[model samples]
Each structure stands twice: as C-alpha cells, then as structure tokens.
Target: MSHTTGADAKGHYFVPAASNYSTTLSIGIFLMALGLILKVNAMPEGAWAMPLGAAMIVYVLFGWFGEIIHENLNGSYTQWEDRSYRTGMVWFIFSEVMFFACFFGVLYYARRIALPELASYEEALNPYMGFTAAWPSSGPMGDPFTPMGPWGIPAINTLLLLTSGATLTWAHWGLIKGNRSHLIWGLALTVLLGAIFLGFQAYEYAHAYSELGLTLGAGIYGATFFILTGFHGMHVTLGTIMLIVILGRCMKGHFSEHNHFAFEAVAWYWHFVDVVWLILFVFVYWL
Candidate 1:
C-alpha cells in the first residue's frame, strides 16, 4: 500500500512548483530596484511606480504562501520536514528579536545619555539659558518634546492588542482539542480585534502629527518612536494575513489534528507579535 496521501506521489516529499519560487524571487528583486529608484529621485504624483512595487511584493507573498499550503495539503512533509520547519521558525523569531533589540538599545542610549548631554551643552553654550534636561511629561516642567497626551487612543490600542492575544490563545486551544467551530470563531474574533487595534493606531498617528507636533523628524525621540512602532505595525499586518489564510484553510478542512505544521508556524508568529506589542506598550507608551 502506498503511504502517499492527498496530492503527494509515493515516496516523494511534497515541494512547491519551481515556477512559484522563481517568480517570487524575481518579483522581490524587481520591487527592491523600484524602491531604490523611488528613494533616489522624485516620482510622478499618484505614480504607478511605488504602488506597482508594493503590488508585486504582495503578489509574491500570496503566491508563495499558496504554494506552501498546497504542499502541506498534499502530505509531502514527513516528520523530518516538520522538524526543519520548527527550526526555521525559531530562527526567524530570533532574527526579529535581534531587530527589535537594536532599536531598543538606541532608545536606551538616547534617554540615558544623549539627552542629558544635549541639555547640558545648551546650558554651557549660554550660562543664562534656563534649559533643563528631563524626560518628557505633560506637567508644568514638562519637556517641549513630550507628546500632547497619552491617555487616549494609544491606551485603547494597547488594551485591544492585549485582548486579541488572549483570544488567539483560546483559538489555539480549540485547534488542539479538535473543535473546529470554536477554532474558527476564536480566530475570527482575534482578527477583528487586530483590525480595530490598527485602526485606532492610525487615528493616534494622525493626532500626533497634527496636534502634538510629534513626527519622524522631531528628534531622536521621534525617530526611535516611529521606527519601533512602524515595524511592529508591519508585523501585525503580516500576522493578520496569516490568520486569514489559516481561516480559509480551516474552512476547506485542510488541517488535521496530526498534521498542521503550517498552522503551528502561523501561531508561533502571532504569539511573537503579541510579545513585541507588550514590550512596545511598556517602553513606548508608559515610559
């Protein structure tokens, strides 16, 4: 009897079609080139240039993920392949951790050392100057660089993302218990909560730019603030896409209790996003 199942051939590990990987790589290179050109020179208004570049990158991801799903459904992966996947996911998460660490290090340096130096130098440059070095706050002695306020949408967004993390955990439990209905509902709620979080964040950004005068160019503080949060927003976008695809697969009965490495990988990624947000909430918002 043949051990092969789904779309897999006997004794063959399921792999994506060559064209899928080739096309994805080609699109990636093209997007990089286009982005470089856009960064270097002025482009036309509503130009097809930037949008086309983004579209190509999205196209590559969609096709690449589709191929992976096809392979998973075909039963081409064995135990060894599953182990390889887990290792790959661990490494990917590690790389993301390092990326965030670098940004946080910059924040620490600016807050602990550079800000004081700038303020002291301002005082020395003119002895009569009343400049004082302090962390930004919304009080009488608050630094000018302080955000207008922090009690509104940013706080709400923090709550939304934290709740979504809990909801996603519930969904993962449903998957483990083989409760497809519970799993679907949990995932739906998580995705909706995530979208709401992002929406609120957009509102907060608009308010900051318009009212608080906080922007990427405000200073080192503004630059670090945007870089950390911006990268996190990008991760949330990716995680939401992953959840949507997983939901689609669940509807099609593509995952079984014993074979769902793809789902596991997505779950890992979602959890990482949740953790990143927790750190951001503490350092970026509360601090």
Candidate 2:
C-alpha cells in the first residue's frame, strides 16, 4: 500500500498509504455503544456485551496507539503531517462539542419548553394525570428526588479541573521553553488532579444514588445529571491517560520544543473538557 503511486507531478498533499486502525476502531466503538445502549435499557440478555466490547476495544486501542506512537517516534511525520493531525484533532473536538451541545439542549427543552407546556396544557386539560411545571419533573411517580447543588463535591471537582487546566498550560509552556523537568512534573501534577477529580465524581455518583435517591431511574433530572457528568468523567479518564502517555514520552526524551503536536492536541482536548464542566456545574448543578 505504501508503494502505491497515487501522487503525480502535480502539487498534491501527501498522505500515509497504509493504515487500517480507523475501521477497526469504528467497529469497536459500535460494539461498545450498542452494548451500552442495550445494557442501560435493562436488556438482561445483553448484560455482558458492553464489558466484552470494552475489553476488545482496550486491546485494539493499545495496539493501534502503539503503531501511531512508534511512527511518531520514528520521525515519520513531517510539517504537513503535523498540520493534518492538527486539523483532524480540531474537527474531532468540534464533533465532541456538538455531542455535548445536544445533551445540554435536551436539558433545556425538558426544563424550559416541554415541562411548562406539559404542565400548562396537560394538568388543566386532562385533569386526571397530575403534571407539574417543574425544572426537575416528578414524572408519573411524583417522587421528589433531591437534586445536587454546586456547593460540596461538585465545587471541589470544578476547582480540581480548573487547576488541572492551569497545570497543563504550565506543562505546555515548559515544553516550549525546553525544560524537561518542569514539563514532566507539571504534566504529572495535571494527571494527578484529573484523577482526583474523577474520584470526587465517583463519590458524588454514589451519594446521589444511595443518599439522595437520584439515579438513572429518577427520570429526566437523573438521566441528564448522570449522562452529562458521566460522559465528562469518561473524557477525564481519556485525558488522564493521554497525559500519562505524554509523561512517559517526556521521560523518554521523545518530544522537542517545536515538534509536539500530540501534547498540544491532548491539551486542547483537556481544556475543552474543563470548559464543559464549568458550564455543567453552573447550569446543571446550581441552576
């Protein structure tokens, strides 16, 4: 595949001729998502599918990333390739932004438009079903599940993420300045902060489920709460892993002052995740 003569004398951008990781990754993701959907919807027969998919993807991820990192370490990427990587990462982040935007939009529709209309029309017109115009709707069960506030663990998690962002920026600056020690320490701290943030989030989820009676079964409020924060937590986990990889590369003396697109891409993603959490904290938790 690499020997294929796709480019001619005309000015055309070069692309790697051999890569099959993308299709495999897509298949892994489809399996994971399908299994998750089935499991979340209470399909007992498919309970093990998500774990099976996750295990397969974990294996594939290790192999796939090993190949890419090996290529990067081998100095296979040129300036044009770096630019392509940047463009691709930007588009990927944009897609993630859209994904979170849809979830947030669902929250808005449920709280502002749908709930009010349901309460106004259904409560008055139907007279049999008791519907209320509430931000966290009681649904048919009328169980007033407690909503989490921004004061306690949520606030602490917010602080941790913000600090992680700052630490990441510090690491980037250290990289630009060619300070290996500073870079490694800053990145290590950032990963630590991210881990701590996830710890708090896990505790919060458990508290919500047991103490507050908030769960996936708690209707729209719980669903949005878990989905938004849960997704963000997953991103944090990915970002932490990315940072750990960067830390390892730093120790191996892999990245230079100018040639570190991988670090920059992960930093961009981590900052985006931080910003999303701030929005989540403000609207979902406090409001």
Candidate 3:
C-alpha cells in the first residue's frame, strides 16, 4: 500500500510560507528613498539629517534581518536559496568595490593632474609665491596642505577599528566552533570597540573644525578628505548596528553551523569597512 502526506485544505504545504524576499526588497526600497530625500534637501542641518536618515535605514535592516532569521530557523530556505544568497553577496561586494574605486580615482586625478594645472595658471600661480607642490597641503596652490596632526586621535582610532576587526574575526571563529558564550562575548567586544572608534572620530572632527581650520569647504584637499573618511564613518555606523542585531539573534540561538549566511555577510561587510579605513588613514590623514 502507498501512503500520501496530507496537505492543507488549500493544497499547499502545511508550513506557513516565509516572506523573506518580499520583506528584503521592500526594506531596500524604503532605505533608498530615505537616502535620496536626505541627499536632495537644502536645509542648514542637512548634514546631520543625512546621518539620521541613515540610522532609520539601519533600523529597517534590523527588522528585515529578524524576518530572515525567523524564516531560516523555521526551515523555509532550501539549498538552491542558499546558493542564490551566496551569489547575491558576491555581486554586492563587487558593487561596493566599484563605489570605492570611483572615489579613489577622483582623488588621484585631482592631485596628480587637475590641481597642478590650476595652480600654474598665471592669475593663481603667484598666490603661494615659490611654494612647491606636495600632496595634502594648504594655501590653494603647490604649498603642502597642512592637515590636522595624524599621530593623535586619528592614529588611536585606527588602532580601535583594527582591533574591532580582530574581535569580529574571533566572533566568526566562535560561531563556527559552536561556542555560544564565546561568540556572544566576542561580538560584544567588537561592538564596544566600534563605538569607541566612532567616539574618537567625533572628537577628531571637532578638533579639525575648531582648531585646525579643516572645513569640508576648505579646498580640494579638505573636500576629498571629508568625503572619503566621512562616508567610511557612516559605514562604520551601519556595521555596528548590523553587529548588534546579529548579537540579538545569537542570544536567541538563531543560527547554526551550516546556515549562518547572515552573520557571515555582516562580518564580511565589517571587515571591508575596516580595510577601507586603513587606506583612508594613510592617504587622507598621514600622507
């Protein structure tokens, strides 16, 4: 005799369907809208407004991730879905790499070609007298741009973020080993380090603006410095929030060795941010 499993009255699987894809797409659209709105605003406080909107995006991501974890724990995902996720992550990282490459290219072109031509113009050339061209300098021409000192808080922040990267790797290793307590502790330490890095960055920005006269509108140097480092700071904020959500899920026992894609993705993002900051530190601040 052959046996058949009973389905629901509607002829569907007994389990409730997971809405992971719909939720992810909806949250992504909402975040994009918020970011665009903040970017187009002309208010005097628009700078702060952008960061506030970014925080809202992070809030949406946390909720959306919760749904994903719920679905995963409920056995809603299949092997094919897991493969799709990995492919999606690869493309996402590729896009981020391109994004940073654009900024770095602009920096290179400005310093190596555009600035020199502008400085040599007859009307502008005499402004700095006989000053020689050098990267990271002030006074509108070939003069060495006087950046705020590099060895103080900026250096300290470098150490903090680098250490956070190490701690996050430890957390990943703990997760792989199935050591729940160690994983939680490692994640907690990474978050704390990230917060400290942000705090020190705030202090350094204040000093740059108040004492060193390094405003975003100062010149090409200041503009590029702020744009590069500022965007990286925003990423750090997002990464920290991602870690907090992962920690919450860990506490709830949401992940397993074979199905921890969400945790691994965030860890990858955090490490990417860490590496970018290292380049920013050397090029924007120290050089």
For each predicted model, how many residue pairs clash, with residues at least 3 apart or on different chains? 1, 0, 5
lDDT of 3 at 198: 88
RMSD per model, one decimal: 4.3, 3.5, 5.9
lDDT for position 25 in model 1: 60
State the RMSD for candidate 2.
3.5
**Residue-by-residue lDDT tens digits, candidate 2, 139-227:** 54545688898899999999999999999999999999999888999999999999999899989988998899888888888888889
lDDT value for model 3:
0.76
Model 1 TM-score relative to the real fold: 0.84
Writing each residue's lDDT as its tens digit, candidate 1 over 1-287 gives 34444444343543444465666667666766776687667754325655666677778777777776666666666665677789999999999999999999988887777666656664447443554446552222232454534468767877887888788778778888899988888889888988988888788788778877777756665777789888999899889988988888887887777787777888888889888888887787778
Question: Any runs in candidate 3 off by more than 4 Å, and if so which?
Answer: 1-63, 121-132, 138-145
* Lowest-sum lDDT 10-residue window in model 1: 137-146
Q: What does the lDDT read for residue 193 in candidate 1?
A: 88
Which whole-number lDDT from 0 to 100 does residue 132 have in model 2?
Answer: 78
Candidate 1, superposed: residue stretches over 4 Å from native? 1-17, 20-23, 26-33, 44-46, 121-130, 137-150
Q: Please give the lDDT score for candidate 2.
A: 0.84
Question: Candidate 3's residue-wise lDDT over 176-198, tens digit each?
Answer: 99989888999999999999998
Where does candidate 3 clash, by residue pair? 136-145, 137-144, 137-145, 138-144, 138-145
Top-lDDT candidate index:
2
RMSD of 1: 4.3
